[model samples]
Target: MPSADGGTTSLPPIPLALGGDDPCTAASKRTAERASWAQKSLSLPHAWKLSQGEGITVAVVGTGVSVDAPALEGRVTAVGDAGDDCVGHGTFIAGLIAAAQSKGTDFQGVAPAARVLGVRGTDERGTASVGLIAAGIRTAVDRGAQVVSVASALTTGKEELTGAVRYATKRDVLVVAPVAPDGETRPTDAPVDTYWPASAPGVLSVAGVAANGTVLRSADGAGEADLAAPGGAVVGIGPRGAGHFIAAGSSAATAFTAGAAALVRAYNPDLTAAETAKRLISSGPPTGDAARLDPYAAISVVTDGTRSPASAPEESKPLKLPVMSSTLQDRAMVVAGGMAMLVLLVAAAAVVIPRGRARGWRRP
Candidate 1:
């Protein structure tokens, strides 16, 4: 039971505010069925190295979390109540990032093993302003969260939020931005119109998609979706604090993606926030109508490539595109020549087969 914006919350300010959801791993069986297949399948995303994410903490900036939820019972670092659960938004976002499976339920996050730092920025009214958003990001960074997940976005141009993002990126922390929901707008008519931190350079902007693997209404529609996760009327703890509700919007998607990042950083302890983020963005679910989040591949890349003795990539997973390499240009030419030769052969055969052509070459 936390208090209003300036008041004391029902739970204490410590663990309730910034510690990992301390649930027992033994009690919660893993539900990531895609785990084993993720390595072999380029399109399906999966989470691996569960326990490794223990020490890392994720700072979630949104409405706030409920300290006593089953998924987060003993795991809460704070003992007393910090405040009241006004809007249910922050709790759901936190649950997506670090909630455990509770005594009886299947909902969980990409990094169930990591900790959570809840930074409340919204009130009963709506989204908070740049001053609050900047303060939240800066506080989370100072508290040592390697990954900062901002499930909320700005509607207008703001200098302070941009500065906060720049500062966080410079510190080598992975900052996740959830694409704004409908109605949260700026005057520029641009979906990203300098929308403070999310549109600010250096932050990873995440978009939402439906469960049917569509970036729009359904599979038939087309649009830009970076990494899609479960965002439909997803079930989450409610306001009185434990009731359930079906929630939507990009916030849920952003939380899931951020949790995935925590999983990568947890497994590959040697990776800096930038390299970890790169691994996540580069290899996403390859086959869906919309992109899906990839946690395992990110860990593998950072672990094998950046960590250890720092050797060249293996033959099986060779660096195919070496970023503006001369070989890349040469390969492109080779592919083009092959296509051209095939087309020429087909055209020539088409013209010569008018009469007295070989049995195999006769036009149909």
Candidate 2:
């Protein structure tokens, strides 16, 4: 079984004097309450104004998420008797995608109102076989998940997984998978073509980027990297509501992208899965280091049929009257008359200067 890393390498150090009113505790709480930088970078707030992924069901397939996590309180639903999670990687991804503000903190998920289906494809140790993961994908899709997020990438391409991907695609369910982060420490050195599920046809492969919108050094170059999103220095809820921890990897980036996809679906229920993916591609920034997600742009394209969403009305405003053709024609005539006068002056100057010079008849 290949071990999937959820990327939560370390949890921030906790202060010894932990109290609700303690300064350190208060500071930590404040940071946790603030919306994540990834969400802000993706313009999720503006996107939220259009849609909160209200009717979309996002399936998180990986290590099990803590269904009881405070931030995930009402949004998580477990499928079958999936095993418990010890690594908490799945929980963090869940939090990134759908966590809501809790305990006086303000850090809300990208699609805070979207529902999550937690499918425990991996064991307690966070390792799973190709078959298990493939099963998880199909189960999520079969259970009515509009978006299935597979947080792990494997080198060994399994027939079951490929079939599952095609199954989801044919059903118009968006399947998102992470491209293995590139580097010496990458989980698999497998060729990009062999990145199972991610390389599968119709699956959207995501890459990781830092706060400055630069692709991480460990980013996966395989799967053609469909899109990139903020992944570095990510803060998310820990297992069983322990607290928030920082993580980095393509897994987090995939979660963010999945949330963006959910927003598009929620904004326009009429958009087919293919149309939603196209909306994201059309709004996504250039790929690789400069690739950045624009959730508002993507949502607007689907909701308003434009590249950018029209600004919201401020205060009580009256609609302005449309400009009339007569007004436009008058302006055009004024401009034409000015140009005509300028041409006349220039012609007169040309004639007068040459005549004056000729009359002088002196090589001054």
Candidate 3:
């Protein structure tokens, strides 16, 4: 997948196998305001009932899942060699996708209601070949993963990764691809120019924002960024240990948002993945370009058919998304300018701290 960064292509090694799991120190539950667009109104935190993503299975396509983590302990189902946690990348992602551990513990993920199916696609050494990722996508879809979250970059063949994305879409899977990291939107080249599946139509592409509840002004803010979520600061399992930290880029945001979607699915089991996505958007605070995703707001949309409105961007329109692939939508700029069907190669995600790797400590 060359990761769309024009970098080298090579697969890293897998993590060692773990037998089972236990509970980590859960964080203390404290009610606060539902801040992210994932929550529409100024609602109390810990107020919205978590759906537990009970019947929903969210497949995380990454290095692999940490089956023994207290959060995902008995919840992991692997089609591969039972997957491992070599880099702890999958553990962090899986944790976000479906970690509902005790309060006060630092080992919980978003949308703890959902179940996770880990498909080990990437290897250690910080490299994920295109073939491994694509295969992982196929496996996730086959395993009944309604929402497939891909955090790695297109490090090898774009065709292979895109094919895998298309396959998942054809089977009614909702795929979210994170855009590659660009150099802070250089004035010469457009910001949205880089990255793969994120540029793909059928797939939902995500970008990051800061913790102050403000989207990154440096972010291209092109039409591709459907909705922005807090990516700058978070608490999750990293290589060395855990603390209040920030994970950058659309990769982190995608996992967080995917967890919200899982919660929505848990709340309502019948909605199609697309419908679920739309419902989620309808429920969250609105941004001119598109409605940012909000878990709390979505609950209202489901239960009351009304959600809070979003703040308007300078000239952002009240996005009227349709049902077909956003690719074919006349108004939906799925792929801007010259990247109609470009696919990225194999590579590790740039602009990101793999949570455990040596070189991933960048924070701005």
Choose the strongest candidate by TM-score: 2
What is the Å distance of residue 348 in model 2 from its true position?
13
**Reference-based lDDT, each prediction:** 0.56, 0.71, 0.57
Candidate 3 residues 1-364, lDDT tens each?
1111112212221121222352222322221111222222223244236455677788877766656665566777876653555566666667656766544443356666678888866654334667777888898998899999887655236677778878987887888766543223433453345455665556666666654455544344543465565454333443223221123455666787787777777777776666665666556665545456566666546533432212222333565975686547655565543254443311234423354367656556
Candidate 2 stretches with Cα past 4 Å from truth are: 1-10, 13-33, 181-184, 188-193, 289-291, 302-364
- Measured with C-alpha atoms, the lDDT of residue 309 in candidate 3 is 15
lDDT of model 3 at position 191 = 38
Whichever of 2 and 3 has more TM-score, that candidate is: 2
lDDT of 1 by residue, 1-364 (tens): 2111112112211111221333211111222222111112222224543433677788877666556556655443321222333455666677767766554444455666777777756543335667767877887788788888886666654578888887898887888876555222322443343344666666766665554444423211112344565554344443333333444556666777787788877777887776776576655654353346666666664333321111222344566754777988899999999999999999988877764555456446
lDDT of 2 by residue, 1-364 (tens): 1111233233453221123433312112213545556766777778889988898999999877666677778778887644244557777788788887776665677888999998976765666568878989989989999998888888875677889888998999999887764332556444444567777777877788777776766664454577788776677776565366666778888898888889889988998777776677657667553246788888885322322111121243466986779989899999999999999999999998899888885666
Q: Candidate 3's error at 354, in angstroms?
A: 83
lDDT of 2 at 55: 88
Backbone clash count, each prediction separately: 27, 5, 45
Model 2 backbone overlap count: 5
By TM-score: ranked, best first: 2, 3, 1
